[model samples]
Target: MSKIDLRKNIVQYMLERKQLAHISARVGIVLDITGSMQGLYKNGTVQEVVERILAVASKFDDNGALDVWVYDHEFSRLPAVTEQDFNSYVTTQILKNKNIHKFGRNNEPLVMEDVIKKYTVEEQSSLPAFIIFINDGGAVKSTKKVIVESAIQPIFWQFVGIGNSDFEVLKKLDSMEGRIVDNANFIHLEDISAVSDEMLYDQLLNEFPMWIQAATEKRIIR
Candidate 1:
């Protein structure tokens, strides 16, 4: 597909144009690169989502960029994605990387911990972060513990399930115990192309404003 087509799809299904000015958090994009996601990467859905996320970050982040990561059995930190390099970066680092297509078990905690270490423990910056984590199925064991621990940090995890997989663990996260605040949201997208931008953005970002308010009151973000 042409880059224009990808941009059009992003505008049609992902950009929250009206809400951009209100968002002030730094952003991160995490994609599950397990075998099940091969079709998504091949058909350009992953690329489109990446572009859409960058669109949001460009408006909200001072740097106009996002940290990107991919995982299966483990996580790999990719070079930061910005508007300029987004297309080439995905083409070379993701679609063309031999390691991306390998089949491995899903491990969500690894990515979660990586983000926590970078933004929470290490930097300890008060800038709240929003993470878009896309996966096709349930995560490996330890995801629950990692998520619960991460709740105390200044981050919001928005889990997007692509395809028809059952996201049992993600669905139960909202009601999970021991969290300082409900810091995560989950949505399943059966057909990425068919969803409207407003609907997808609404579902993806609806809880974030409330999260920012709660986190600020808790002194997690200043």
Candidate 2:
């Protein structure tokens, strides 16, 4: 089989295993454009991530379009990426856009708020929203409030720390208190390239299915 077919099949199998093949969600990706992540952007690692994520969206997302956002101190929500237009998406949609706020400081809460609005307010879907957030480092305490508040919404935050940087704030996601349900999860990958696609998919999907069940039972999602 061809590469795209293989990718879709792999994701399909993962969904079936999780017993999540029957569910549909809206998928989004939040990428950190702070100075620390410049190397990943320049070397095409971020592009590879988009392709892998798009594969997951194809199987799980209702529309199969991965909503894209890149951020530094400010965030810009770019176009949604579908299978046909995902090639060179990061380079063309993000890096090439002079209007994008690129490579500066970290302000996770600003973009985190935008993600919540995009899924919970703007789209207003009963289906759950699955967001893959990629950050290199520079976690701040203020980001906690955003995640805590979003717990009641129909959104699940899956945070992926892609480097050896101290992701202190993110590490607290699972244990955070005052949330109706645990809406966030974090995973650290020192070297994303060293991990296989199956492993990555497993890690990403590990907590999501459980969250869906919990959210449904609690009426957070219908």
Candidate 3:
């Protein structure tokens, strides 16, 4: 199916079922660009991921653009993508960008700080921020503190693990204490390429509506 139909059929149907049809928010996607991810990038799996994610963005974001970021030890905050430019986004924008610090070690806190800064400081908005954070394990301990501090803000982090790695920090997002409200969720998909779009969308969106409800009640999204 084309992207428009994918948005109108699968994602929108699920959003309506989950009662999120009228919700409005900013959408963004962050990718892990460590050495281990080269295979996924080379095989075009990353581009497919972008297309699937852009369909979700089309529904939730007013302008139908998905804000983009790829991070390793350092990061590169790329341009936002819409349906028009989402084709081959990973190859054209990320892989070819000489300035992007790619294939380094994973430093979750460094990128996490910049992500919070983008929503809370740079382009401050009242709308809640939904962030899709994809990684292949190696989640450092420093990310816990950042996630805890971000709990008070209007951002929800959805962490998706794509490969078989010991995702210690991401696995504990829910039970992490001292948060004003639960602000993040983690799901591991051993091979994202193997998952059907319907299932992938379901998994990606599972807890976001719940977060919207909780963040609303806590006045974190007002």
Candidate 4:
């Protein structure tokens, strides 16, 4: 069978079984670079997890569009984040503060608001947008407010808790009674140790196909 047919079948199965969201969603990642993420793993480290996320994102780029935003209260203080700025920001700002494990960092929590504002103003397109927020800590009150405000948008907010993060924050983000608002449901990993290399790889491989199914249903990528 053709790849397209395979993808369709997968989508159908996901809808029937996983109740998974759509495919053509434009994925935007907001990773928390706090001080705590420096926690290590057996093979390599949590940095490996970060690398895995980047790798998965690269794969998704082929399926559709992908963008990553690494935030800390400190990083946001420097300047506005741009696609062009990711490199320097990573080198000077991120590496300077964050250890290989990546925890206990701060950035303007309001920066999320800025990102949403900039994205809305800059792009007038109608593609589905998904925000995959990877954070190990709680946001300040202001940041939480902005996140709650931004949740009102059509963006599918997926929270992935890194390390031993409190699930309550993530649950609040994902909670939406009637529509996709009033809550932010997230994909969480309670402990970094819980993810083996093989498991991570399998999850990464499945993510794109599941997203494609959701996208096809929403008519975003096609």
Candidate 5:
């Protein structure tokens, strides 16, 4: 399919699901660039997901752009991705040199800390933030600490595990103690392409609105 048509289909799918209809939060995409994800990046799975998520961000984010970060042992922000430049952006910034494969570790807490510090503690925007964190394996030990600490912030973490690897840490996040509220959700995708858009959207978004409401009651978000 042509890139334009693919983009349209993604937008249409999100609209049909009302994924962006009731939310007005900034969207951030935290992609795991570990070695395990090399196949997904090379096979265009990551590219397609980025495009679809950008469609939702365009409707919900005030800037109509997605703040992207790629993490391995650490993390760094990429240029903001929008529908118009997403194709060229990924080609030049991520796919051309196979940069996504360069990262060798999977320290998820670092990425979480960076986002929370930047968006919650520093900028302090009134609108809540929705963070889409994609990973294929478990995170470092520090991830639990960071996640529990982040429960008080105005952010919702949607964790998508894109492979068959055991996601023990993510699976136990909801039951972990000391969290102000359950601010994270995990969904495993064995075959990302085979998953229908409706199912993917439902899994990716199911717990976010509840977190928003809970965070508001706790004064994490205004």
Candidate 6:
């Protein structure tokens, strides 16, 4: 089926199941778009990895709000301030000039900082917000520790490793057994960047169901 149709069907299915309410999650996606991501991999190109991520994020059909933000160091500066600016960076800056940035190499610090700033001081009395960080490597600055420490409590952080970068850092941070992080835990992935388009699609298709399971457990969806 078409992407739109698939998304609509998924949403409709959840609604019919009375579980749509449980799917309400404010998901914030922090994507790294540095130049090094363009490196050749055994499975596919770096661009392919990015496309896969976008596809996964876009295909998410839950009722919870979705915010996708991408960061790259080519524009100079550690973090790009303002969502409007960050959005513009993806559509205008990065889309127009794709040669300068690598994926996770140089953009981690900026992206992390930007993400933290986006929801750091917000007063959340209801549901906890979900933040997913997908990068290929490490951070440039020591911003993660400070941001993680200062950010208001009760935030769920997820890290997805894309390339040859060290995923051990993610393991150290994750407290949960599964990918679901409850109340200030980290969830991460190893290098799944080398998969082909078909493989990537299958992987994502398998993973999407977990989002529903987590949302249900959290009572975000029915």
User: Root-mean-square deviation of each candidate, in angstroms?
Assistant: 3.4, 0.9, 1.1, 7.6, 2.8, 7.3
> Per-residue CA lDDT of candidate 5, range 1-93, in tens?
865456546655664575446668899999888878888888788888887778668767889889998888867778889867887565577
What are the TM-scores, per candidate, against the unseen true structure? 0.87, 0.98, 0.97, 0.58, 0.88, 0.53
Q: Candidate 1, residues 141-209: lDDT per residue as tens digits?
A: 578888888888889999888889888888787788898888988888988768865576668777887
Query: TM-score-based ranking, best first?
Result: 2, 3, 5, 1, 4, 6
Model 6 Cα lDDT, one tens digit per residue, 1-222: 854345445544444344333333445666666655544322244333334443333434233234556666633222322212323334443455555344444645555555555654543434444566666666543534643453333345556666566654554553433333233333233446444444444433343344445645756433
Candidate 2 ranges beyond 4 A from true positions: none
Better of 1 and 5 by lDDT: 5
Model 3 over residues 1-222: C-alpha lDDT tens digits? Answer: 775665557888888888898898899999999999998999998888888888888888877899999999998889999988877789989998899988889998888888899999999998898999999999899999999999999999999999899798899999999998999999999999899888888888899899899999999988
Alpha-carbon deviation at 156 in model 1, angstroms: 0.5
Tens digits of per-residue lDDT for model 4, 1-222: 843334334434443443433333455666676655444422344334444444333333324333655665543323323323333344454456343334445553545765576456676446545566667767554555666565445444556666665655455643433432332445566765567644543443344444445545555334
> What C-alpha lDDT do the candidate models reach, one value each?
0.78, 0.91, 0.89, 0.49, 0.79, 0.46
lDDT of 5 at 27: 91
Whole-model alpha-carbon lDDT for candidate 3:
0.89
Best by lDDT: 2
Order the candidate numbers by lDDT, best to worst: 2, 3, 5, 1, 4, 6
CA lDDT, candidate 3, residue 185:
95
Compute the lDDT of residue 205 as modeled in candidate 1.
73
Write the number of the candidate with greater TM-score, choosing between 4 and 6.
Answer: 4
User: CA shift at 30, candidate 6, in angstroms?
Assistant: 1.4
The predicted structure with the larger lDDT, 4 or 5, is 5
**Tens-place lDDT digits, model 2, residues 1-222:** 856568889889999999989999999999999998999999999999999899889888988889989999999999999988988999899999999999999999999899988887888988899999999989778999999888999999999999898898999899999999999999999999788889899899999998999999999998
- Top of the candidates by TM-score: 2
